[model samples]
Target: MAATIGDRENAQDSVRSRKTNVSESTMFTQLKTREPKAQENSSTRSFVLLALIFIGALVTLGIVYLNFPKLEEHEKQYIRLPRDIEDAKKLGNILSLYKEKYFYQVLGGVFITYIFLQSFAIPGSIFLSILSGFLFPFPLALFLVCLCSATGASFCYLLSYLVGRRLVQKYIPDRVADWQSHVNRHKEHLLNYLIFLRITPFLPNWFINIASPVIDVPLLPFFIGTFVGVAPPSFVAIQAGTTLHQLTSSGDAVSSTSIIILAILAVLSLLPVLFKKKLGAKFD
Candidate 1:
C-alpha cells in the first residue's frame, strides 16, 4: 500500500512538471510571433509616411509649374535690358503696388515668401533683395533682407543635417563630392571656412547653403557666417535698387565705382579668416 501511494505521488509530480514546461514553451512562441509583427507594422508605417512626403512634393512641384509665367515670351519682349535686372525692376514695381494697396499684409507675405525661397535654395532671391531695396528705404530694406536671408539659410542648414550625405550624393553628386572635400579639409576651422566662403565670390550662395548640411557643419558657425557674409552684398544690391530708374540697360545697372566697392568689401570680409589661418599655421 505504501509503495503504491509513493508511485502515485511521483506520477502526479511528473505530470505537473510537464504541464509547466508546456505552458512556458507556449508563452515563448506567442511572444516571438507577436514581436516580429509589431516590428513589421512599425516599418510599414515609416514607409507610408515616406510615400506621403514624396506625393506631397510632387503635388507642390506641379502647382509651381502651373503657376509659373511663360519666360520665353517675356524674354523676347525685354531683349533690350538684361533679363535679371529687368525682372528685378518689374518685381519691385509689383511689390511696391502691393505695399501701397495692402500695406502690412503685403509686407508680411513678402517676408514669409522670402524666407521660404531662401531656405529651399530657390532662384530669384537676389532679384527679390534688389526689389526690397527699390520698394523700401535703404535701412529698412537692409534689415528686412538680411534678417529673412539669415533665417532662411539657417533652415537650409537644418535640412542638410536631417537629409545627410545620401540625399546630396543622389541629387547633386558632383557638387557634393567637390564641396565635401573642401569642407573636410577645413572642418577643424569650420567657422572661418564658412566665413570665407560667404564673403568670397568663390562659390554660389545657393551651393553653400545646400552643401553645408551634408558636411556636418555646426549651426552656430553656419548662421553667423551667413548673417555677416551676406550683409555687404545685400547692402550693395539694395543700394543699386535705389537707382533702378537710372538703369537704362543692364550695363548701366552696376557702376564701376560700385563694383570696386563690392570687390573691396569682399576682400575685407575675408581678412578675419585669413588672419586666423595664418596664426594657426605659424603655431603648427
Candidate 2:
C-alpha cells in the first residue's frame, strides 16, 4: 500500500510539470504574436507626430516669408532657403541689397530661419551663419548666431523631453545608455562639459541636441553653455562671412588657425572642472 501511494505522488508531480510547461508555451506564443502588432502601432504613432510637426513648421515658414518685405521678381528667386554655399551667396547678395532699407524685416527673417533650422536639426545653419556675417556687423552677427543656436537647441531639447523618450529608448538604447554614463560622470560640471562639446566636434551638434535632454542635462546650462560655447566657432563662421564673396564652400569657414583656436577654447572650458576635482581630492 505504501509503494502504491509513492507511485501516485510521482505521477501527480509529472502531470503538474507538464501543465506548467504548456502554460508557459501558450504565453510565449501570445507574446510572439503581439510583438509585431505592438511595433507597428509604435511606428504609426511616430509617423503621425513627425507629420504634424513638419506641417506646422512649414506653415510657420510660409507666414514668415509672406511677411517679408517685397522684392523684385528677379530677386525673389534668390530669396528661398539656402542649401549650399552658392545658394547662400545669392541670398546674401539679395539681403545685403535690401537689408539697409528694411533692416528689422531682414533681421527677423534670418533670426527665425536660423532657429528653425537648429530646432529641427536641419543641415543649413552653417550657411546661414555665414550669411549672417555677410549681412550684419561682426558683433551683431556673433550675438544673433549664438542666440539662435541656443534657442533652437533648447527647442530640440524640449521636444525630445516630451516625445522622444520612447523613440530614443527603442532605437538607440545602447547609444543613449553610453552617453548617459558620460553625462553621469560629469553631472557636477555639466555646463563646462557642454561648453567643451560645443567647442569640439567629439559629437555632432544634431546628436548632442537630441541626446542632451535624454541624458538629463538642465535647460539653463544647456542654453548658457551653447550660447557661450558656440561663440568661438561662430566667430570663425562670421569672420568668414565678411569675405563671403571669396568663399567657394562652407569648408572655407574652418581653417587650421580656427581649428587651433577652437581646440584651445575647448581645453580652457574644462579647466574649472579639473580644478574643482583637484581641490576635492586634496581636501579629502
Candidate 3:
C-alpha cells in the first residue's frame, strides 16, 4: 500500500510539471503573435503624426498669404517708406486712435497676427515692426515687438526642426545642395552664425529664422541669441517712430547715425567668437 501511495505522488508531480511548461509555452506564443501588431501600430502612429504636421504647415501658409498686405505697384517701386513720411504720420495717427478706441482687443489681435507673420517667414515683418512703433509708445511698442518677434522665431525654429529641411530639399533642391556643405561645416557653431545673420542687414531676418531650424540649431540657444540679437535693431526702429513728425522724407526716419550704431553693434557681437577662436589657436 505504501509503494502504491508513492507511485501516485510521483505521477501527480509529473503532471504538474507538464502543466507549467504548457502555460509558459502558451504565453510565449501569445507574445510572438502580438509583436507584428505592435510594430504596425507604431508605424501607423508615425504616419498620423507626419500627416498632421503637413496639414498644419499648409494652414499656416494659407493664413499668412490671406492676411498679407496687397502690394501696389507704387509701393513696390519705392525703396523708401511705401508712402511719403507725412502720409506715414497720418496713418500712424489713425492707428493710434484706433488702438485707443479698441484698447487691448485690437492690440492683442495685432500682436497675434504679427507673431504669425513672423513665424511663417512672411515678407512684411519689417513694416509690421515699424507700424508697432508708430501705433504704440516706445516701451509698450518695444515689448510687443520683441515678444512677437521671439514667438514667431520660435515657431519658425520648430517648423524647420520638423519639416523645413525636407521641404527645402524637395522644393529648392539646388539651393539646399549648394548650402549643405557650408551648413554642415558650421553645424556645431550654428548659434553664433545665427547671431551674425540676425545682426547683419544683408539677409532678411525672416529667411534666417526659417532656415535656422533646418540646419539643426537647438531651440534654447536659438531663442536666447535671437532675443538679444534683435533688440538693438528693434530699439532703433522704435526710436525712429518717435520722431515721425520731424521727418521731411522717408530717409529721415532712419539716419546715417542709427545705421552706423547698428552696424557697430553687429560687428561687436562677433567679438566673442573671434576671441574664442584666438584662444583656441593659442591653446592648440
Candidate 4:
C-alpha cells in the first residue's frame, strides 16, 4: 500500500512539471514573435523623425530664397560660419546692405539653423553661437541662443523618452542605473542639478539632452535650467562677436573671464546640496 501511494504522488508531480514547462514555452514563443515587429516599428519612427528635421531645414532655406533673392550671396555665405576675419567682413557688408529688410529674415534664418542643429544633435551649433555674435548684438544673440538651445534640447528629451529610452536600458543598463540613482537622489532639486549639468562640461550636452527625459526629468526644470544655465556661455560667445573680425582662432573667444564665471556658477549650484546635508547633521 505505501508503494502504491508513492507511485500516485510521483505521477501528480510529473503532471505539474509538464504544465509549467508548457506555459514557459508559450511565453518564450510569444516574446520571439513580438520582438522583431517592435524593433521594426521603432526603426520606422526614428527614420520619420530624421526626415522631418531635414525637411524643416530645407524649408528654412527656401524661405530665404523666396523672400530675399538679392541677398543670395549673403544667404550662401551665411549658411555656414565665417572662416576668418575677411569672411566675417564680407558677410557683414552684405548684412548691412539691407539691415532693415534682412533683419527679420536674418533672424528667421538663425532661428531655423539653431533649431536644426540642436534638434538633430548636429555638431555645428558652436559655430552657430559664434555666428549669432557675428550678426546680432550681445543681448539679442544671447536671447536667440538660449531660446533655441532650450527648445531644441526639450524636443530631444521628448524624442528619447518615447523611443530611445528602451534602447538605453537594453544596451547601457549599468550606466543608466547608476545615473538614475544619482538623479533620483536630487529629484527635489532637479533644476539646480540641471544647471550644474549645463554649466559643467564633464557630460556632453547632447547626452544630457537625450537622456534627461528617459530618466524622468520634468520639462519645466529642463527648460528653465537650460535657459538660465546656458546664458553665461552664450554671453561669452556673443561678447566675443564684438570682435569677431579680430578673432584669429575659435579658442580666442572663450576668454579666461568667462571660464571662471562658468566655474563659479558650477560651484554655486552645489551649495544647495551641501547646505541641506549640513542642516540635516545639525538637526540630528
Candidate 5:
C-alpha cells in the first residue's frame, strides 16, 4: 500500500511540472511576437511621415509654379541656366522685357521658390539667387535674396531639428561625430564659426543645415549667421545680374576677386572668436 501511495504522489508531481512548463512557454511566445510587431509599427509611422512631407512639398511647389507668368513655348525655353553666362544673359534679356507687367508675380514666385528649395535642401537656390539680380535692382534684390535664404535655411534648420536629424545621426554616425566634435570644441565661439562656414564655400550649405541641429547649435546664431554670411555672395550674384549678359558661364559669379573678398570676410568673422579663445586661455 505504501509503495502504491509513493508512485501516485510521483505521478502528480510530474503532471504539475508539465503544466508549469507549458504556461511559461506560452508567455515566452507572446513576448517574442510582440517585439517584432512593435518594431513594425514604428517603421510604418516613419514611412507615413515621409510620405506626408513629400506630398506637402509637392503641393507647395505647385502653388509657387502657378505664380509664374503664363509663357509661350519658346519663351519657356528662354529660362536660362544662370551658371552658364550666355544662358543668364539670354534669360535676363527676356525677363527684363516683362518685368514691368509681371513684376509682382515674378517676385512672389521667386520668393516662394527660394524658400521651398532651401527648406527642402533642394539644389538650384544659387540659380534663383542669380535670377534675383536679373529681376530686381541691387538694393531690392539683395534684400529679397537675404530674406529668402535666411527664412528658408531657418525652416530647414527647424525641420532637421524635429525629424530629419535622427535619420542623419543613425545612418551617418561618423560624419555626425566629426561635426559634433567641431561644434563641441567651439561652443564659446560657435557664432563666429557658423559665420565663417556661411562666408566660405568650403562646407556644403546642405550639410551645414542638416548637421547644425545634431550638434546642438542654437537657432538664433544659425539664423543670424546664415543671414549675414550669405550677404557677400548675394551681393556678387545681384551685381552679376546687372551685367548678366556679359558673362559666359556661372563661374563668373564667384570670380577670383569675389573669392578673395569672401576669404577676407571669413577671416574677419573668426577674429572675435579667436580673440575670445586667446583671452580665455590666458585667464586659465
Candidate 6:
C-alpha cells in the first residue's frame, strides 16, 4: 500500500512539471510576438516626430517668405522657387534689381532659402547655386554656397541621426549596409573619403547627408568634407551662374572637361590613404 501511494505521488509531480513547462513556453512565445509590435510602434512614433519637425521648418520658411520686402505685382510671379532654367533666369533678374538697393534683405533671403531647401532634401538648390553666381561676386558666391551646403547638410545629418535610422534601414537597408562597409574600410581616412564622395557622382549629396550619421560618420568630418568637397562642383555651378543670361539649359553648365577635372580631384582625394597604407607596409 505504501508503494502504491509513492507511485501516485510521482505521477502528480510529473503532471505539475509538464504544466510549468507549458506555461513558461507560452510566456516566451508571447514575448516574442510582442517584440515586433513594440518595434512597429516605435517606428511609427519616429515617423510622426519627423513629420511634425518638417512641418515646423516649413512654417518657419513661410514666415521668412512673408517677411521678405513687399514686391510689385509683376515681380511676384517670378519670385516663386525656381524649378527650371527659365524660372531661375527670371528670378535672378528680379533679385539682382533689389540686390544693390536691399543688400541685406536679398542676401539673407538667399541664405535662408538655400538652407531651407538643403535641410529638407528639397530640390532646386542647384538652381540657387547657379543663381548665386549671377547675383554675387565670385568669392562671395563660392563662400555662401559652401557655407549653405555644409550648414544645410549638417542639419540633415542631425535629423537623420535623431529619427532617420529606422526609416533609412527600412527603405534602403541594402544600400545603407553597402555604404557602411565602404565607410568602415576608410574609417581611418574618413575626411578624404567623404571629399571623394562629394566630388564624384557615386552617391547623391542627399544620400550622403542622410546616410553619413546613420553609418556613424562624425559631424566634424562630415561638415568639413562637405564644405571643402563641394568647392569643385560648386565652382562649376557658380561659374555657370556668371553666364546665366546666355544659357539655354542647366545642362549647359557641365561639360566633359569639368567631368574630367572632377574625376582627377576624386582620385587625388584618395592619394593620402594610399600613401598611408604604403608607409605602413614599408615600416612593417
The candidate that achieves the highest TM-score relative to the unseen native structure: 6
Q: Model 6, stretches more than 4 Å misplaced? A: none
Estimate every model's Cα lDDT from 0 to 1: 0.70, 0.91, 0.68, 0.77, 0.80, 0.93
Write down the TM-score of every candidate: 0.64, 0.88, 0.62, 0.80, 0.80, 0.95
Relative to the true structure, candidate 1 has a C-alpha RMSD (angstroms) of 9.5
Indicate the worst ten consecutive residues by lDDT in candidate 5. Answer: 79-88
**TM-score (C-alpha, index-matched) for candidate 4:** 0.80
Residue 32 local lDDT, model 3: 96
lDDT: worst 10-residue window of model 6 = 60-69
- Candidate 4 global Cα RMSD: 3.9
Query: What tens-digit string does per-residue lDDT give for candidate 3 at 191-263?
Result: 6666666766766776666566665567887787787778778887777777766767645556788888888
Sort all candidates by lDDT, best to worst.
6, 2, 5, 4, 1, 3
Scored against the true structure, residue 162 in model 5 reaches a CA lDDT of 70
Comparison by TM-score, 2 against 3, better one? 2
After superposing candidate 2 on the true structure, give the runs of residues whose Cα lies further than 4 Å from its correct spot: 1-28
Clash list (residue pairs), candidate 3: none
Q: State residue 154's C-alpha deviation in candidate 3, in Å.
A: 2.1
Candidate 3 clash total?
Answer: 0
Candidate 3 weakest lDDT stretch, 10 residues: 75-84
Task: Give the TM-score comparing model 6 with the true structure, all chains together.
Answer: 0.95
Give per-residue CA lDDT, model 1, range 1-284, as digits (tens): 99999999999999999999999999999999999898667556645654564466456545543443333554434312124776666655655655665666546655766776776677767766776778787898888888888888887666555543445655688987888898888777677667667766889888788677776667788888787777777877787778886665444545677768767876776677678889999999
Superposition-based RMSD of candidate 3 using all C-alpha atoms, in angstroms: 11.0
What stretches of model 3 exceed 4 Å from their correct place? 1-91, 98-102, 177-180, 183-188, 245-252
Q: Which scores higher on lDDT, 2 or 4?
A: 2
Residue 221 lDDT (model 4): 93
Query: Among these predicted structures, which one has the highest lDDT?
Result: 6
How accurate locally is residue 67 in candidate 6, as Cα lDDT from 0 to 100? 80
lDDT of 1: 0.70
The digit string of per-residue lDDT tens for model 2 on 1-284 reads 99999999999999999999999999999999999999878767876887688689889988989998888999999988899999999999998897888999899999999998998898999999999999999999999999999999998888777767677777888888988999998989999999999999888888888888887788899999999999999999999999999999999999999999999989999999999999999999
